[model samples]
Target: MAHAGTVSKHPEGFEDYVKRAKLSMPPEELQGELDYWRSRKVLQRMLDGGLITPDEFHKIDELNRKTFSPKLARLMA
Candidate 1:
C-alpha cells in the first residue's frame, strides 16, 4: 500500500529508503561527480571558443568514456 504522499503501488517503506540512501555514494564519489561537471564545463568552453575542433572534442569525449570508471558513469546516468 502507498504511504502518505507516495504514489507507488508498493511504496518503499521508510527503512528501505534509509538503507538505499546509506548504500549510495560516499564522499569521494560525490566529489567525482563535481569533478566530472567541472571538466565537462572546460570542454564545453573549449568547443565554444573554437579552441578545439569538433573532431577533437569528440575524441576527448571518447576518452572520457574510457576514463570515467564504469561505476561513476552509471551513477551519473
Candidate 2:
C-alpha cells in the first residue's frame, strides 16, 4: 500500500514531533501555507473544468490540509 511519496508506516513519536517542529520553523510553516493555497487554486481549476468531482476535490483538499498542516486553514477553508 506504500507509494513513492507516501508517509512511512511507522508512527511518529513525541520526540519525532519535537524534532520535526524544531526543523519546521515559522518560515517553513509559512511556506506550507503558501503551498496549500497554491494547491487550492489548482484544485479549484480542476473542479471548475469538470476534471474532478466536488467530492474528489474535497478529498484532495483534506489530504492537502493534512500534508501541509497550515494554521488557520481549517478556519478559512
Candidate 3:
C-alpha cells in the first residue's frame, strides 16, 4: 500500500525516472532532491500535528528550496 497523499501521478515513472537520473544526473543534486522530499514529508507531518508553525515550515521549506537547487523535478512543474 502507498503512503497517504503521496501517490505517484505516473506510477511507472519512478523506475524509469530514477534509473535515468542515476545514470545521467548529478548524484548530489539528485540526492538532495530525494532528501528534501523525505524531509518535507516529516515536516508536513509535524505541521499537521501542530508540532511546527506554518511560518516555521515555510521558512525551512524555503531553505530546502535554496539548498537543494532542484532542477530535474522542474520538468514536471
Candidate 4:
C-alpha cells in the first residue's frame, strides 16, 4: 500500500536511497547513515585484501549502528 511521502525500496543508486531516507530522518541521523556506509566500504575493502581475519571482520561488522538511531541502523543493515 502507498502512503504519503513513501519512497520505493528499489533504489536506483546510492543517492536515491539517500534522497528518500532523508525525507524521514533528521540531519544528524542522515549524517550517521553516511558515516556507516563509509565505514562499511572500508571494511569491505579490507576483507577483499585479506587484511583482517574473518572473525575480526565479523566482530567489527556486528557493531550496531542501531544504537544510534533508525536512519543509521538502516544504513548499517
What stretches of model 4 exceed 4 Å from their correct place? 1-13, 19-23, 64-77
Taken over the whole model, the C-alpha lDDT of each candidate is 0.52, 0.65, 0.62, 0.57
Clashing pairs in 2: none
What are the models' TM-scores? Answer: 0.52, 0.64, 0.58, 0.58
Runs of candidate 1 exceeding 4 Å displacement: 1-24, 70-77
A best-first ranking of the candidates according to their lDDT comes to 2, 3, 4, 1
Evaluate residue 53 in candidate 4 and report its C-alpha lDDT on the 0 to 100 scale.
82
Question: What does the lDDT read for residue 39 in candidate 2?
Answer: 74
* Candidate that scores best on lDDT: 2
User: Candidate 2's residue-wise lDDT over 9-38, tens digit each?
Assistant: 333232343354444445556556556666
Q: List, residue by residue over 1-77, the lDDT tens digit for candidate 4.
A: 32334433332344665765557665555555555555567777898899998787777766734442436345435
The TM-score that candidate 3 achieves is 0.58
* Residue 26, candidate 2: C-alpha displacement in angstroms: 1.4
> Mind giving the per-residue lDDT tens digits that candidate 1 earns over 14-70?
234325445566545444444444455578799999999989987886676566432
Candidate 3: stretches off by over 4 Å: 1-24, 72-77
Whole-model lDDT, model 2: 0.65
Clash pairs detected, candidate 4: none
